[model samples]
Target chain A: MSQSVNDLRVTRSQRFIREALIDLIEERGFDALSVGEITARAMVSRATFYRHYRDKYDLVEQIYAEAMQALFGAIAVQETVHSPQIWVTFFDHVAEYDRLYGALLGEKGSPWFVRKMRTSLINLIKEFGRAAPQWQSDSAHPISLYPAEDDLIPDVIATMFVEAITWWLEHGKPFPPQEMARRGVALVGAIFKETSTW
Target chain B: MSQSVNDLRVTRSQRFIREALIDLIEERGFDALSVGEITARAMVSRATFYRHYRDKYDLVEQIYAEAMQALFGAIAVQETVHSPQIWVTFFDHVAEYDRLYGALLGEKGSPWFVRKMRTSLINLIKEFGRAAPQWQSDSAHPISLYPAEDDLIPDVIATMFVEAITWWLEHGKPFPPQEMARRGVALVGAIFKETSTW
Candidate 1:
């Protein structure tokens, strides 16, 4: 067989395995699942599974790493003005993997995944701070001016965004990503408005 | 022994058992924990453990139930005006159980616990809406006036609060409950102010 044909076959098998893992996790959660079940669901042999990945943990880590990279890439390329459209781009990235996000962030989801995702989000917020100094200067008092006691502001804001995103995904995305992004910008502005009063 | 002595003994044992469970959960994630380790940590026998509760699940459920009941009680008795003092009172109640809150809301925490707590918080926010129509009315527009597409405002606010509380507890609470409460109220106000702009 030609090299291209082999690559196509490899891609197809991996897609099947990935989808099967996501569906199983959504149904029975990650811990109760097994490689045997994953292979069976994917209709691929255990030999094929072993050939591609080390184990479930390896597979999931790879998947999450890729998804997070895509998410950050989506955010990084946006305009530095910190507009609602940037939020739209972020949510749109999440929308592309809503099923994986829902399975990983649901009640049956892993705490490890949540922590990893939250750290990425916190970094994204910090990146926003770097990309747009005016974002802070726009406030009456810059975030840095707040006493050290209130240094958790970035964390607070990040957690808020994480929880809101979890809420949005868990609730089936009731509003379009664009609408959620619009509301997100407004909410951040409001949070800053309140913070400045201190 | 007198009846009063027996009651005191029972109270002490239960407290020890509860504290042991929290500490153990913090050390090791909940699912990996066992009744034997819990009793061993509490320095109590398995016989004593069974006398008070059915199993680990029963013990955790009872602990959470009591904690949540106390939390609602704290929120319920607050002044209906939704002042920063009310948030202080709420954080005070959480501070009283900061250990358990930390364990349950931490990276090793249970997702079930997070969901249960978030629901309770959402209910608390809804209660506030009913208790203080003036709270909503104080804004240029009432919460109910938002289009259905944006009806997730309450949920967004509740999640923000939960995430903030989790951050506070996880980070050793750099500020007093009063300070965190003050920040919380301001954040909520900002969210509402932005929502009203819609």
Candidate 2:
């Protein structure tokens, strides 16, 4: 019970620091931000901040890493691999953290975050491919029909997903979460038409 | 005859300045470069540099503008609307200016150039949509089969093309120009399958 209490306290402090950092970055700019002000705003001491993160940059990545861990954890529990449910779960996750997503991918936001997100998405895509090998290795979806080389297929899918999310965000998200998920699943279906069975 | 000679002299001087700027940017970076060294390297007097461009920023845009104009010029001559020929012409242009493309889009390169390239591509895509209304308006390809809204379609296509080129360049351009063009067209075809008739 004491260990659990300690863990909860650590989590609360970490969240406060990350949120404070983002607020400071948006208020001025990342270049002008300082660790001192971040701790002050978060109501945490400088010592606590240092114990949790190496520096401001490390904290930014940690925020993204935590989000990815939660997202993939939710995805892992889903029963179906290729269903629209997978995308719906993703869209819901994005909606839940809409502000953070916007700031992280916004025009003034750091490209470092966007690149990190892309790398994570690529890994998730590769994992999806493994879990559901039906996409190609299955007898139904012949590889010759869609001639993208083995190395490039995952990247192409990843780009499609990234571009889709980017458009949804930039356009003020005209479609609801379900609709966006629908369009995404449809597009993926189109790309892997021969393997739609998956 | 004197007027023609004056025009030729101006063009030569402008080209020299632009070349010098590109060389220096590759050696160091655009942020660290100075107008004084640029003039010295180009062997153009300060008077000539100021007469041609208000500053170095203007000159960089001029270089990109000229490249875009030339690319569009070459693309304009092609007869077919949806042929792979368009991408081949593009890949040829990138190959022709391999070093400049590398500097403009590589890791150390500025995102300004990448964004500029994207805007130009979006324009080209819009123009292509206009010139080849045959894809949909011609009545051969129905709208229902491909459900992307009209406004979003051009942006989607533009992103795909940009990401593909960006990938090719960052990967040391593993595939030959012709092969890259082939893959691009094939991917575009897959995206706009029902409308492939265009």
- Top-scoring candidate (DockQ): 1
What does candidate 2 score on TM? 0.69
Off by over 4 Å in 2: A1-17, A20-56, A81-84, A130-150, A193-198, B1-62, B79-84, B133-150, B171-176, B193-198
Taking the tens digit of each residue's C-alpha lDDT, what string does model 2 give over B50-149?
9878888788787878787888788879887456677789998987777777776655565556656776787667655555534454455555433445
Q: Best-fitting candidate, measured by TM-score?
A: 1
DockQ of 2: 0.27
Could you tell me the lDDT of residue B70 within candidate 2? 88
Q: Estimate, for each residue in A1-198, the C-alpha lDDT of model 1 and write its tens digit.
A: 245656877988889999999999888898788999999999999999888889987888889989878877877787653555677888898889999988887766765676667777776665554454454555556655435535455666676777778878888888899888777766665665566546
Worst 10 residues of 2 chain B by lDDT: B142-151
Error of 2 at A76 (Å): 2.6
